[model samples]
Target: MTNIQVLDNPTMHNLLINLSKEESFTFREIIEHTLESFSVNGERQYQPPPSIVNRPNGQNTLFRPFTSDTCIGTKITVESGPDGQGRKSPPHGVIVLTDSKGNPTGLLSSNEITGYRTSMNAFRFLGERMWIIL
Candidate 1:
């Protein structure tokens, strides 16, 4: 069994911020990975529709499973209705990653990364358009 590295919100936030720097090696690798995912060979990456479950307490849980050449994992997020005071809670989730051999490798807090990941697509799109305009 592989040792699982658990990264909470602060750690995950810091890691993502560092990795997102313009000069970071990991950021470049992430771009390469994103581009590869659109390639013919990488088209086989699997991501199925998420499973949603409504809890008795009015919270909905979503499990989104995906697999890549290197790892398989699921991101579980909970969506809660507004409280009695009419204030909605912030979205929160966790990502569980396992190696190709099925060993649990890491568990990451998805709160920050979820937004970061979403913004990356927009950034990538703008970057491509900028090159075209130039």
Candidate 2:
């Protein structure tokens, strides 16, 4: 049984911060893990490109879907103003992780996950390239 956990922004931020400080995984490990997750036996991973729609209030919303061997999810992000001239809010989305039976075994919020993952990737890139010298 999958237990649903609803985490607000503050809680999510705190959790991510804690994980970042831990630095348990090395940079190379992160890169390897990400690449491995993209494929399973031998199939290319696929994800839907983001689509944007303009709202009546001059705002724009983006929708995207991604899938891997273990997870499937859709993300919707709201941006204020037609030209992105107004305040933009973080993405509010859901991620569903499935089991071998194709049943959802876990649900997670995407906003903080995106933020945390992006930061981790950046760190990984730096760590991977930092050793290169001119």
Candidate 1, residues 84-132: lDDT per residue as tens digits?
A: 9877798789999999877899999999877776777677778889999
Error of 1 at 114 (Å): 1.1
Worst 10 residues of 1 by lDDT: 38-47
Q: Which of the numbered candidates is closest to the native, going by highest TM-score?
A: 1
Give per-candidate clash totals: 0, 0
Off by over 4 Å in 2: 20-32, 35-45, 82-109
TM-score, one value per model: 0.78, 0.62
**Among these predicted structures, which one has the highest lDDT?**
1
Residue 130, model 2, lDDT: 82
Cα deviation of 73 in candidate 1 (Å)? 0.9
